[model samples]
Target: MADQVKLHGNWLSPFSSRVIWALKLKGIPYEYVEENVADKSALLLHYNPVYKKIPVLVHSGKPICESMIILDYIDETWPENPLLPSDPFERATARFWIKFIEDKSPVLWGVFLADGEDDREKARKATLEVLQTLEERAFGDEKFFGGDEINMVDLAYGMLARWMPVIEEVVGVKLLDPDMFPRLHALAENFRQAAVIRDNLPDHDQMVPLFKIRREQLLQIAGK
Candidate 1:
């Protein structure tokens, strides 16, 4: 029998998208099982007993949890169209940016979920600062964080490119303005148009409405 590969993922999750992108880039044929995070399935729990999260990559019945870990595994397993750089120094640099984004991603989410004016403003500012630094330092004039083509680091930061606008609409704030963040905005647009990214991206039309509703629900709970 062919190697049975399955991915447990939600349609809207950027975390899940990470796994999807890796699989697609590697030309891996796998079954995608839509997982409802709210009322998670027993199978998901069985696979990822510790986290109980979506994006459990089940390869030959063994599960790999966590989006980044899954990406690393896919890269190592496939080796074709490599995502991480070959050079140790370059690989370390890519890992550094990936770690930075992972650590700071929560602060960006706070811009959507923050209740009070003070908190919202602070979160928004921090998020903007993060974007500015990334544009200046990471990409600069290169096509991607990895330079020339997309890589693991590029995929890691790709959410900001596509989802930030949807988030801006939902939150009623524009963080990645063309005037203020020209390079960042251009980079986002560039990534969105890339062949691999374009084909693999989530449906923004479907996501914007869901994110809007989710943001409103969160705001209500926070008494915004």
Candidate 2:
């Protein structure tokens, strides 16, 4: 029997979107349950007891926590449109980049939550340095990080395509310049335009106000 699939996620969360895109790419039909991060549901807590976070994937009552791990689970279970490359070495490389981004993501978040000029500038510079490293070392000239098609690496970095632009607008700063990071810029554009990714992306206009409020809350908390 095919296992019933359900996804618990927050609409504004890029991490949730990562799992959504993976499921869509692999043609998996799953019911989506939206969660309120401010007041998380009991079911979400039950599914992810450790972190009690959103983006939990439940298949046949078995719960998978964390966005990337959920994607890997989806890929392993379905295995039709493979997210990671089949070659052992290539898959290892993809996993490396995925972990690399996961580790470095906080720098961009720091920029978003920055409350002062000095802090904002510091975060911006750190974010740019991370991007520069990816542009030169990670991506180089590949149309997609997984070569021509979207893969786990591309999905992992999907936040840059949608959320990053919104963040840049909200924060009143630009770190992804085409002139400086041409390859990365092109990758973002291509990633967004891909059929599954394009269809599933959240509306930018809708997200801006929510992000603005969240940014204020974050700053207020930090100030305290």
Candidate 3:
């Protein structure tokens, strides 16, 4: 197939999930190639030599690295289900929030990678700040960050909707409280129940055990 698309990604990765969401939303037919990050394959390394990472989208055999960048590429390639806003100001505003989440991503993930209790607490605090910012400043009265529909910003933040609770359950901390962050909480529910997003989320049961093992491995490596 000359127009064949292939995605090299892992189920455990939020980044990969975002790309998957974008592809499904756009109704693009593609082959999924699962990659184990622990032991990288020659194909994965060749596709993404700079990062040697997952979520690489191969369109017509040309590889595009980075999840966010791949989403943009998908949106551009298939303009039917537009991920970005058509209006210039709205698009700019959307991109602003997209950049915000990208920068603050480490803060949210730190909780999972933190070894000690104190470090985990600190990471939780930072994660709360990021979530609070999203709740307060990001989305106002919109059902989603994209206003009634899932946009690029939502795809960027959508990982938290499905995966955050699992992380909280595994790490034993509740940060995305309903009362504390009403808008974000509602958005999470709405996001999960949305069209493509609903059917394409990761399983909570499977993710919990995998994340636990990963956190333990990370802690041991860091401790050494």
Clashing pairs in 3: none
Candidate 2 residue-wise lDDT, 142-167, digit = tens: 77877888999999998889999999
Largest lDDT belongs to which candidate? 2
lDDT tens digits, residues 104-154, model 3? 888888888886778888999999999988888888798887887788988
What's the number of clashes in each of the models?
A: 0, 0, 0
> What alpha-carbon RMSD in Å does predicted model 2 have with respect to the real structure?
1.2
Q: lDDT at 10 for candidate 1?
A: 92
User: TM-score of every model?
Assistant: 0.94, 0.97, 0.97
lDDT of 1 by residue, 1-224 (tens): 24788999998888898888889888999999998877999999999999899889988888999999999999998899999989999899999999999998897787888777888899899988998787677755887666788889878888887788888877778898898888878777888888878888887888889998888887788676
Off by over 4 Å in 1: 220-224
What lDDT is reached at residue 99 by model 2?
96
The lDDT, on a scale of 0 to 1, for candidate 3 is 0.89
User: Poorest 10 consecutive residues of model 1 by lDDT?
Assistant: 137-146
lDDT of each: 0.86, 0.90, 0.89
Q: Where does candidate 2 stray beyond 4 Å?
A: none
Give the Cα-based TM-score of candidate 1 against the true structure.
0.94
